[model samples]
Target: TAGDTAGDTAGDTPEDTPEDSPVEDDISSNKKGRFHSLGVGELLVVKQKLIAYEEGEIAHIENVMKGEKRSRNHRTLHRTEEFTSFELEKEEETKRDLETTTRFELQKEIDSEVQESTKKEAGLTVTGKYGPTVEFTANAGIATEKSSSKSKNLSTSYSKEVVDRSVHRIQEKIKEKRTLLTIDEVEVINEHSFGNLESVAEHTNGIYRWVNKKYEAQLFDYGTREIFEVVIPEPAAFLRYLATNHPKEGTSIPKPQKPGYMRLYPILGTNEFEEVFIPLSPGLLTKETYLKWVEKYNIQDVLPPPSSFIVTSIAFAIDPVDTGVEDEGDGSLTPNWRTVNMKNTELVVPPGYVAKIGTLSLAIFPLHRFILRGLFGEIAIGTNKHAFHQGGGIGGSETFVLSNETGLVPVAFSLTTKQFFSGTLEVQCRRTEEHMEAWQISTFNAIMNRYEVLKEEYEESISGEELFGSVDIQGKNPLENKSIILNELKRQVITQMTRQTFDEFDAMREGVLPEGFPQQDVDEAWSEGQYVRFVEQAFEWENMQYLFYPYFWGKKKDWPVNSRLEDTDPLFKSFLQAGSCRINIPVRPGFEIPINIFLSTGEFPWDSGEGGIAVENEDGEEERDIFLSIAEELKAQQGAVYFKSDGTVFHANEDLESVLTGDLIEEVNDDGDVVLNDDGEPVLINGTNFLEDDINREINIGGKIYMIIAVNEEQQKITLDENISIQESVQYGIGAKAIGVPWVVTVPTSLVMLHDGNKLPEIPEAP
Candidate 1:
């Protein structure tokens, strides 16, 4: 009631109106003076005064009308008419103000409603599940259902039963089969070696849920390397399998045990194989040869091609010769020992010059094996000669030209491989107006925070392990040991210093720039930080094809591409932070593509433990599930399948084939004659006649008989009970053994989809 005290009707206009208001004179004066800024409290006071003035004016007019008679009535009518227009105008202004305030309040309510609706929709799209048990709703028509033309369809072409059957068939195809192949049998089966290769294929393909069902695929050896055809369900698993099972590149040589003997020793890095040649012969090395070997040992860059060999010789000529032979011969005209000069005076030979009375000169490259020709009548095989051994013996008068008999060695030989894990994922049940902005924001925050934690842990975990080999300074010949230890310590410091510089380079790559630092400055610092070209050399040596996440088909160019993970752009980081990428596949009416399937890896750098990486857990961590719990969430919001883009549908279970043992033969009593089916051909009862078909088939031929375990009529293959062993009869054991399996068995969701009760999103037709 107090709220309605302002005014009742238009005839009794509130005093707040401009007509007959107490503040009317004050307002008019302020308007004329042009100094009319009023505070909220002052304005409210003026409004009350105006209301009082209007009430007073209405009362005065009513009194005048009552006091006068007929004569005053005429004048009163004229006055009322004149004031009516003014009163109506003032009332209209009041109504306008009231309407504006109501609209403003209504707008606030609408905004809140829209926000709440958006949240609800997002939850449904991300967490909803749809299948036979759940009803398909209109909201499921997300971005995936839209098309440019009527021909583009993104709906299931077949019934859900077909997809389920397809999944079951795949499961059966990869079903485990027991095999008992003896060592001799394995050797005989050379053309189709089903031993190791088959095992590998089975392991690799078995990890995926969709394999060996409709499409026929196999793994075979073409030369030394194994080839997989449509078999890689997850690249991370494939890489790990190869690293563990595949042979290392180089061969291991037996170490010579003799006291004075020297041999080649391979130094293994995470991504490189380096052979260190022992017992370097300083005498055989010319000045040019000495510098080249020394520079490579220290991992320094090779100087540009010498204008003349003399230039290189003169550069290192300051160092004196350290190797020579001693003479210990009987009294004879010929000298028993001759010293080989490796000094500046030992004129360097021209390129490709094989002297008649001298040794052959050949260049040795990095990561390649080479043979060394010893002047002592033995060949030393190595990459390069770094040290020398001096001895006295009967020396030959003439030098013989050495032959180039060095065998080549490949890179990464004898080095361990890096390991990682991967899997696939898909999103389902999104509505048409759905936006991924929220999901993207959440993902970026999660990943960036996780990365920060890991990075901090790595930096804090550094214990400064020395780069050089450890030497005990307290052992015998302590002084010599101390000197060696000191030199090692110095090298370690230098290495750590270089690594720190590289760390800065990494910071720059990651967009962590110094204040006021220019792009040119970063480039210059990067070049200097190479420090003899050392920056993740191990990773370079490994030569991984897809070092960073190889975003699937449509997702590749979604963001700016960076050659290395360390330099990925902001948009790419956002995608990674989101922990998912969208992929598009073709769709048809009978076939449906499930949005739950995706290809991904559970790899995040810095999470990999020190020295090398291991799977996040003994049983590799489930990747997509870690980001969002689709399994449980979908259960609550049943009957919705979400999709991000358009794609082709997959038809399920189009092939079906099975085989079992033939009916057993049994004696029958029918007038002392054998019973058979129609056509007068032995009416077999619960028995099969082998003679029915032209081709003869027998079970456990030439051996004890047992029941049939399983059969696949598509391939005419059969599995007999393990108790029975058939003899080596080609015709009898036909289609008995199971083959075609690679690596270990574990199904990836990306390659072969699991169709349980999942339904496809509905597609809207074009207008």
Candidate 2:
């Protein structure tokens, strides 16, 4: 009774809840995290360490006879008292009880928590933690419950079961082969793909899910870089079967290796004639030679434009890029934290730009409420959070134990996407309501902190809001209400830097000097000294699109996007200090447009170890700067529309208008009018900037009025419908097989005869 000083609530202990009192109960109930069996080599190593630390030479150090010039000390006291230490008896006993009660409780977790103790391989030595401290390894020489044995056993069983099930299901599907599916049957397939990843028989229309599983979604390309559409009797059911079924050994279900994701769309009804928008797995819908196509195709701007990531915000903090902040210290609050302000951080990652956010960029954009209200679609407020809480203790103790007065400060805002220009987007914002108390475990002693509730409640009730809806086209800045996908209580540096500048820009324009930092005001005006040229060029540049800032980047195994980072190095350092941490990734890149941005980790190509951005292990740290470089080159398609349809017809800018119709009349360049030579053939413009490769060239195809068509690599012919061409009534289509995917060559004007009868057979065929 004396040791139990508490209000009488029983049946469990270590309460893991916000609503529950500090001692409400059952907290350690789910403490199990990781487990692994011991290897023979590892066992020997541990045993050696324990022996050395225990009864080895050091045990009788000073006791060695004082002969010659060797031993002078009286006693080199033995630090090892074996596994049972009388000093730590009380807590050790309690831990033992907890494990004996729960058989599955893993020693790995204990080892992780207290490394020095459990690491030694002293045969059957009690792990000081009490009950299961003496966890055995399969290679422990004698009878020991090795963690590897359990893992191997389970893995083998799972594999066998999967094989058996796949065979059984295939047989079933074949037996029940049916004909044209009805709409009901089709929708079922669609719905299944939405959920089950391996359900072969459960063909789904579209494989849509909280694939990010969390509320948010990130868009990614399928293998082919296109919005792939494989039409089956029941698109949904087929996809479902594909998803729910397991792949055979040695073979895996085709998946994006680096990104590990793909967005799928469903084809409905028995319509072989239907053409659905290919979802972006690329190859499915990735960018190609758009230079030749842009003016000719008449399509809007492209998604995932290239550019650098810069920070502009009000809640700015500036620290040496090297310094990192953490939980128990003043790193976060260091005066010189932000380099910019908050509002200024709101940015549009320009088309053709990839903003690589360093920690400083994030510090400027901390936990501000970013409200995204589209007049054309769903309106909501959210912040992608690098999860933090203003509470005590390590885990969620300080977080979840909150007073009934409030909810968590950081809550989730899930959203649905609409066609953004010609692309899709996943949008996350900064948090708005800091006062909102999340889950808490409050009692006579304390209350659950704000952030804890969010961690707990995220999995279940996040979908309460109607994440989707259409919008009314009205205002100019319709998405005005600021909803930050990442929210923080304090200011980041970038916010400060930019805010000062913006305010100065406003002041100078109005002929008024604000209070502090007059030079900052002047500098702000100076940074934009080139504003005219930038704006002019921006205006000159075509369609513009906006993307959210980087909130959190992580692996798929991480929880929902919870962790926050200000600068890359610092944020990473902070994570390193946290031991084994699991941050949220907003984890969705499919179904939504890239509302934002991944870290350089295990999944990325240039990783040294599992999830090692800073290279805690290994050498040869090759940075993955090349992939982004490639994507950039691909996005900036720089060439004229090469049309090799009838012959070598090249069109650029306005010349591409109504290109497929009749003789394409153009205002040619005076230097070389893209005209025919004296022999009535294409006069090759040697050394033109238009050609990236001498052998291969790109050409635009479709247009609003008339599109350009080219001929195949081998065949020097392009057949057009009688309506399109004035010469012959040929209904043949244009084919250019030589122009391998992406890079294409346009046909010359002579090959395609005009209705008005203008013909110049000058251009030669594409080699």
TM-score of each: 0.12, 0.16
lDDT value, candidate 2, whole model: 0.22
The numbered model that scores best in TM-score is 2
lDDT of 2 by residue, 489-541 (tens): 00111111111112222314343357444332333233333322222121101
Tell me the alpha-carbon RMSD of every candidate.
61.4, 48.7
* Candidate 1 Cα lDDT to native: 0.24
Best by lDDT: 1
lDDT (Cα atoms) of all candidates against the true structure:
0.24, 0.22
| Candidate 2 ranges beyond 4 A from true positions | 1-557, 560-702, 705-767
Candidate 1 wrongly placed segments (more than 4 Å): 1-457, 462-561, 566-767
Worst-scoring 10-residue span by lDDT in model 1: 42-51
Q: Kindly list the per-residue Cα lDDT of model 1 for residues 1-767, writing each as its tens digit.
A: 10101111112211222424322111111001001111111000000001111100011111112222222211111111111111111111111111111111111111111112222223234434676566444433322222232222233222111100000011112222333222211111112111223322322111112322122222321111111011111222222234333432221221111111134444455453433334333233333443443332332332322221111111111121223322336532221222222211222223322112222221211111121222222212122122222122211222233232111210000101011111111111111111223233333333333433443333223211111224523222423433432333223222221212122223133333675453343333333333222212111111111112333422233224322222012222222222122211111111111110100111122111121212244477722212213452342123121211111111112231112333334456768867766676765442332222212222333333222345444333444444332222122222111123323322211123333322322345899
